[model samples]
Target: MTALGPAASLRDAYGAALVELGERDPGLVVLDADLSGSTRTQLFGQRFPDRFFNVGVMEPTMMSIAAGLSLGGRTVFASTFAVFAAGQAYNFVRQSVCYNRANVKIVATHGGLLVGGDGGTHQMVEDIGLMRGLPGMTVVVPSDAATTRAATFALAERNGPAYVRLTRESLPTVTDGSFRIGRAAELRSGNDLTVVAVGALVARGLELADDLARLGISVRVLDAASVKPFDEAAILKAARETGAILVLEEHSVLTGVGALVAAVTAEGHPVPVRRIGVPDLFGESGDPWALLDRFGMSMQRIRDEAWDLLRLRGRVE
Candidate 1:
């Protein structure tokens, strides 16, 4: 694989990618709930002012408008903060988007405690958990800028309700290759343990795998970018082959990707699984990296958790 440097932030990548979508499809319209610049939809607004609609700060109303547009043969991409997407538009998305099965893509930025310094009010650590519970909704958290670009284009092409969770800070670009939705990408091949990671934590998981390999612990890391309609067959195969699995994420541990993986593995392969993510608590105002370390989202934490799970699984198997 080619070496990757620092990737573009989700905001930047989303803006550019959405603009490209607009260039390709005339029906592609963007709706922002008074966060055009903050969510980086301002780029689209600049390019196609008529196509971009800013419906004040009212999230629910914006969702309804987007759904109506979709029904009228328009592909709507609603941009907002994760809090507003999963909070204010909760009922609207459930009814207008998911229930009606509209082709609306909800692009939410500043997800997780990575939205640091904004405190608990802005950090959307539970957004994925909320969105994942909705019926007919495809939840995706692209690991980096490249993946986010691919996901943005993919969501635009697909017709249905899809929720995209993006981060506030820039992250390492681990994958420069294109990714297919609902397919897990194998970062490393190892039979000792499988580390299944999603979103921002994927880079850390891959680093942990490399570090563990130096310690004679072969680690398999899979990037589960597409959360909903999760690649259960791939996950089960990893568990049955490796006998242990560790799911990592930047969101809360409960009802998030970790819980979903645990549920899937328990029902199928019945292997020992460990979940590393934010505990059931709000994050305080702090630097993003420090907060990630505090909440066990660091590469070191992943390495330790994988080792611990490997030992436990070894004893069981």
Candidate 2:
């Protein structure tokens, strides 16, 4: 855990990290589907012009080219909006990347409802579920700019197909720049309950834990950055120690990290679990924070859910 800092953009951090990784590894290549500016892959293109490719607006073609590059022993990273990467280029990713287990990193930005005014057409709320279902695909959703920076480097070293989810909005820095795939970081420790959160919701989870602390409710907050190959050991430990769990995410409740957490607990140690996320519906155009609140992912909603879980567990009178 690290001290909270001012808000920073994960996309910017990701772009800078790609430049750093390119400088370190000559085999690393980048591809963008006409969204380099918005997805921040332009930074890497500027630094490594020869190693970067702009594949026009064809996301599926970009994915296929990345897969071919990976098969040629080059570490390929492709960037696009989540909607385009996961929705438009899904078949290419499945047949070329995941099926072949190519070393391609699909770093999609503007995930979830945080695309702000992009409306339902551009916002990708189902990306996590889509990517996680792919076999041999590593799913990572870093909580902040620092963690995103670390995850960018980690994915470069990892030899497999991976999907790194990033947000369009700025988020508070939470982790201390150390991130590993398939590992969860415990931001705060307590015994009453455990709140598992990811991406932008991590900062909100920390706020809820702090607020609950004043009311004598101790909450252990776990940042579940890696959605697939989830940290089951940490989750089971929390279940045994706290006996209650609440999962928070900026994506849909169905097939999100919350559902994975529930599956983990059910197999090992059954406990009361409450999940707070967007219900089964599309997101509309609005302020990013307003959209989050409207979708019931606000800090206030998380706090209320915490209280409800506590009551159900007989921890609150």
Candidate 3:
């Protein structure tokens, strides 16, 4: 609803939200694979030590335990890096949690190139695709701290398997606290082209819209927070109204929200779509912002792609 004032860490908001949830719901329990400090689950662990389980570095074991706890009538929140939670423990999550439709919330932190100095090994850009592929799993990537807090609470209340991808770097608050899973928020409206963004790229999408506006290009921006069970209505509306779309994300362009948006539009509207994100390659150690720029996730790349797509559609010269 309003422009972002200052950057706030999503992981910080996640920890606070977990503490609040612990206070409100005694049925809630948390498990971490020794990454509670980085993943921000330590706040919950400190406040509700009895309800928290530090399962060492065994991510799969933690996932299995979470599934068991869920079966025992407790809403479980498991924390770990995106790579471990969605990549390493994927099989366990698929069979143990998703198969039984366990009420488990896998809140993964340090997703994408935002891990910065941690390099490619720790920075997970494919977790969204992995989690989204699982049957009966709800995937969410909140853009900022406020939305992260909202998503955390929403996942805690909802039943079944869910993955909330979070970033390590701080992000400006772009949401107004009105967050609903499976629904996208339209930040800017225009008719020339639609820019659909997820996670950390939403703020860049908004800035892209502003810059394009100054250049006489009317671009609409849609925050695709809910990767799984995506906002089909909003996407289709943008395709129909704008006639062209560009999908932006911090993950790989191959299997992230861009791929999903393209598939959805191809089936329903058949509009010209372009995807901007990390390439199908591993990232190296560097400043987070530099990595984003190098991987073509920056506003410049988005602007270039928008212009290219518009030209292809004969909307620009």
Candidate number achieving the greatest lDDT relative to the actual structure: 2
Question: Compared with the true structure, what per-residue lDDT tens digits does model 2 show for residues 214-236?
Answer: 88888999999988778999999
RMSD of 2: 1.2
Q: Which ranges in model 3 have alpha carbons more than 4 Å from their true place?
A: none
Rank order (by TM-score, best first): 2, 3, 1
- For model 2, where is the 10-residue window of minimal lDDT? 1-10
Q: Give the higher-lDDT candidate: 1 or 2.
A: 2
What C-alpha lDDT, on a 0 to 100 scale, does residue 209 get in candidate 1? 77
Worst 10 residues of 3 by lDDT: 1-10
| Residue 161 lDDT, candidate 1, scale 0-100 | 95
Cα misplacement distance, residue 293 of candidate 2 (Å): 0.5
Tell me the spans in candidate 1 whose CA falls farther than 4 Å from its real position: 1-4, 315-317
1-317, model 3: which lDDT tens digit per residue? Answer: 34565899999999999999999999899999998998889999999999999999899979999999999788999999999999999899999999988999999999999899989998899998899999999999999998999999888888899999999999988888678998999888899999999888899888888887887888889988988889999999999999999998999988999999999999999999999999999988999989999998877778788889889878889
| lDDT for predicted candidate 2 compared with the true structure | 0.92
Instruction: List ranges where model 2 is wrong by over 4 Å.
Output: 1-3
